[model samples]
Target: MSVLVVGASAAGLSTVESLRRKGYREPITVLGAEWHLPYDRPPLSKQFLCGDWDEDRTRLRPDTMLSALEAEFVLGDSAVGLDVERRTVHTASGRELQADAVVIATGLRARVLPDQGGLDGVHVLRTLDDAAALRKDLLEASRVVVVGDGVLGAEIAATARKMGLSVTMAGPQAAPLQSQFGPVVAGLLEELHASEGVHLKLGTAVTGLTDEDGRVTGVRLETGEVLPADVVVVALGAVPATDWLADSGLRLDNGVVCDARCRAAEGIYAAGDVARWQHEDSLLRLENRTNATEQAACVAANILGDAQPYRPVPYFWTDQFATKIQVHGRPSEAAEVTVAEGNLDERRFVVHYRRDRRVVAVLGWNMPKQTRLHRHHLVHA
Candidate 1:
């Protein structure tokens, strides 16, 4: 059976690779909106943005490996519409491609502020082009204000500080990732950013952007305080890139709603950030690199008649400064965090997040191997 994959990122590539590995040697077509090859995104805010890694380093695979896949890679053409009944994808360049099965892995688009448009120094790190533009402005910038305090914002702040720019992190949360890791671990993250010369401007919302002569001058906060900046990076999260599928007749609530098997329709499946599938009692959508590949594999298997459900223990990681933080399982803000191994003050430790008196998540700070071992606690719990 021929398959049509609409997206050329990690999820789309993984789906094609998995299909071939599982011995499905039918014709495969991969469509992409961007001109570049499938590339890694996690480093866009850190290594790629900071000039430590070039554009070539961000590519997911070399040309030789991709050539071996024997699949058609259609780049720079976006899928604008879908025919649910006929399983045909209409592209922006007016090409209608029909297949036996269609996979939607469109991923996400970075959210931007209202006043961020038409400004010279405002940036958002979503794609490689976005990263390149931001890095260009950041090289000539002296002061930068990052508008968000989650993982992406924290990493951007750390990278800017390392580039010798005056960086300020602005957000409404009590600390960085407070809603994800709760007060204790997030507070420690705040300390790490503070110690690394990133000014903490948390607990307040960013009102707007101040501009002068079509260039950003500062970031205006809710409390009437304006943080001066030569550049501003808005890392305020993202929404599923499903606007093109508005008339597809498929369920779309926050994302492409799918069944437990990641199937949206008879021959339509979804994976990655754009897919919200049933997991046990609830509908879940994961927006990490690991989830992209894992969910793609599940979708590919089910396409090949495996009949398996996609149930994964959530996992994500971030590198800020010299610390590498890894989290296994979902940890709520209301969960109680307790040290499971090592000391919190020593800056290298593992902690368990408990809710309803049971371990729900494990987090490791600067300890990779030990933290992975402790992840078993989450699986057993």
Candidate 2:
């Protein structure tokens, strides 16, 4: 059977690799909007931006490895529309392809602030080119302001400070990452960033971008204060790349709505950040590298008639300077958080989050081993 995968990132690549492992041995095709090969994204604000790892090192699979898959790869061409009735995909490069089965792993695109007035220094990090362009600016920038409170913003602020650039992070939340990790853990992170010389302007809104002669000079806030910045990186989150599937008749909520088996429709499946499926009686959408890999494998198995539910304990990790933070399961669902190992004073610890007298999740601050030992508690949580 001919299969068409509409993305070539982690989720799309994992699906193809896992399908081969399942012995499908059929003709497969991958369509990618970016010309570069699939590359790891976690390092965009870490090693890649820091110039510690070159672009070549970020590739998920080398040319030699990908040649073994024997799949037709169409890079630098984006799929513009999908006709599910005819099992056809129309591409921007004027190609019409047919497939017996389709996988919509098109993933996410970074959200941009339209009112930014098309300033030269305003950037959003999402693809390889975005990071490369921002990395060059980071080296030359003296003062930078990041507008977002999520993981990407925090990581970029941390990376900027590490590069000796003065970074001021502003977000609407009361504290950074409080919504995801809750108040206690987020409080510690706030202190960590403060100690490292990052100016935290939490609970603030960005009013506008101040530019001089078509170049961003600072970011204006709601409180009538303009934070002077040589460069501004908008790390606002992403939305699913689902516009191509608008007329395809598949359910589209926050992403392509899928069933417990990750089936979007007959002969169609979805995985990654673009696929929001049922998990434990709730519709959950996870946008992380770990979940993308797990969900893709599950989708591939279900496509191969394995008849298994794609239930996974969601996990994610981020790096900020010397600290490596990892979290398993949804800690925000827990009402109480208790320390399981190490102490915050030592800058290394594992915290256990519990709900209704049962452990639900674990968060680690440079303590991966202890956090891993407690993962079994989440299986039934």
CA RMSD of each candidate after superposition: 0.7, 1.1
Residue-wise C-alpha lDDT for candidate 2, range 1-381, written one tens digit per residue: 788998999999999999998899999999999998899899888889888899999999999989998888899999998888777889998999889888989999998777774788899999999999999988888999999989999999999998899999999877788888888888888998999999999998888888899899998899989999989999889999999998888899999998899988888889999999988789989999998899999988887888888888889998887888999888882359998889988989988888888887889999988888878878866
How accurate locally, in lDDT, is each candidate? 0.95, 0.90
lDDT per residue, candidate 1, 272-295, as tens digits? 999999999999999999999999
Candidate closest to the true structure, highest lDDT = 1
Instruction: Score candidate 2 by TM-score against the native.
Output: 0.98
Runs of candidate 1 with Cα error greater than 4 angstroms are none
> Alpha-carbon error at 31 in model 2, in Å?
0.5
After best superposition, candidate 1 residue 257: deviation in angstroms? 0.4
Which 10-residue window of candidate 2 scores lowest in summed lDDT? 326-335
Displacement of residue 352 (Cα, Å) in model 2 is 1.3
- Residue 309 Cα positional deviation in candidate 1, in Å, after optimal superposition: 0.3
